[model samples]
Target: MKNLYFLALLIGFNLSAQELPNLNLLNLEGKSVSLKNDFMEKDKIYVFSFWATWCGPCINELEEMNELQEEWKKEINIEIIAVSIDDSRTQKRVKPLVKGKEWNYNVLLDTNQDFKRAMSIVNPPYTIVVKNGKIVHIQNGYVPGNEKDLYEKIKTL
Candidate 1:
């Protein structure tokens, strides 16, 4: 039974890789946004990093990505959309936190966590490198130097 479940999960992930899941996550302004359907660009690669206000490691990873924002845009047409998986209890804190951090990102809210489960995201700091309507790479967690590696992977794809 465990093996069967694993197999099904694998197939689900494969399908997710081939096509972006249609999810109705809300932006910081409470407007519904779909990463693929609403924000598609001609050749832009999107990095969707799932995080929460309380996740320390998640904040670290996002900060690292923030530092490289200029270089990434200068080199490639890319956008990093930070998706907050904070529930309703803490959702109200998102705006102030973002402002305090000065993270110039299209901060989206996954207040219900629907997108996370639908995309099979297990935890915070999970990143999906997407391009041309498909997932190019996925990074589950991060270390201090992982941002450099992320940039290199984006360069190849």
Candidate 2:
């Protein structure tokens, strides 16, 4: 019975393994990048945080995640990526804001909304946690205390 259950679990995981699109985005220095190839690492828990400059919840979530950077790295092999979905209007402020806050994680540009659309994200403050090249968890909206839940999920990985 145990062997049958384990075999079923393996088959389920194999069938549900779908990767994000190999789309090109930009880094803070304005260089084109591939999200899967460049940012992702093998056997790591990486968080893709979709945010914008003007969003209050988004800012709060990112700042909270930034605070957890050092500890998360020390404990688990995790990386948090801040992907901005700001358009041309507010895109210029992204750099100054990030520099001002002194965020510790890598920032990526999705001004054209290409990456966001590809991922089917419809809102800000959404998070995707990937482990071993597979997306294990995703949160659509964030509340003030959502970081704790995210941490717990990563711990389970």
TM-score of each: 0.88, 0.87
The sequence of per-residue lDDT tens digits that candidate 1 reaches over residues 26-137 is 8878788886687677678899999999999999998888989998999988999999999999898889999998999999998889878877898888998888888878
Candidate that scores best on TM-score: 1
- Worst ten in a row by lDDT for model 1: 12-21
| Per-residue lDDT over 64-106 for candidate 2, one digit per residue giving the tens place of the 0 to 100 score | 9898789878889888999999998999999999999999878
Candidate 2 segments whose C-alpha is farther than 4 A from its true place: 1-16
lDDT of 1: 0.87
